[model samples]
Target: TELQEIAPKEFEGRIKRQGVVNALDDEDFAAAVRETGRKKLIIAGVTNDVCTVYPTLTALQLGYDVQVVADAGGSPTKMADDIAIRRMENAGATITSTVQLLAELAENWTSERGGKIIPFVMGLMPQQ
Candidate 1:
């Protein structure tokens, strides 16, 4: 699997599973998340309608602060994507874009983390 093949060296020993559309439905994945002891979750899945929506709603119900990276996931159609976004928002998940998430994490461009992230983000932008 691409995920397993491309996982970074730091996550080598981490639990990585396949075959579950809703990741939270997998006991191992859910247990791993619980073990993290983190209340906030940043989630992005391949398909917004199924892979993303199901878990976002479940996480909200489970009392985790959820942020769905909108642009990171896709749907078969624009309408499907919009519907999924609205559903998640109504369920109390924060919908954010990739750039927005990076900025929120970096905070200030003058800071050490920002200094590195800004350059990487810029590289992703199209040159005009």
Candidate 2:
């Protein structure tokens, strides 16, 4: 596929996680990432104080260089966001932007970064 040629190395896979507080297990999550042959994880979700933070924390504890993209994450209120960020920090989670993830994964302009990503960045920047 066209996109595959753009970033053949940075493939991602999805997994299903099911459990309650203090009951959720991360081995399966780790397995999914392993299945993709990646050592680092980037994730985001709602209710950042719980659903988002818990698993990411678990990932860090498991030794994955975890970065939670903040723009792709959100909470119901400012209080929730505050608590979520604090909890994630306590758990050793690094917060990063979506753009940062793109550049890291892209690695260089030889591929998609310059070819297919220009329009996307154009949208993020203020018009001249």
* Candidate of highest lDDT: 1
For candidate 2, lDDT tens digit of each residue in 18-65?
665421275675555677777777768756766678778877877878
lDDT values of the candidates? 0.91, 0.70
Error of 1 at 18 (Å): 3.4
What are the runs in model 2 whose C-alpha is more than 4 Å off?
A: 1-30, 107-112, 124-128
The per-residue C-alpha lDDT of model 2 at residue 15 equals 44
lDDT (Cα, tens digit) per residue for candidate 1, span 27-96: 9889999999999999998889989999999999999999999999999999999999999999999999
**Total clashing pairs for each candidate:** 0, 0
Candidate 1: count the clashes.
Answer: 0
Candidate 2 global CA lDDT score: 0.70
Runs of candidate 1 exceeding 4 Å displacement: 1-7
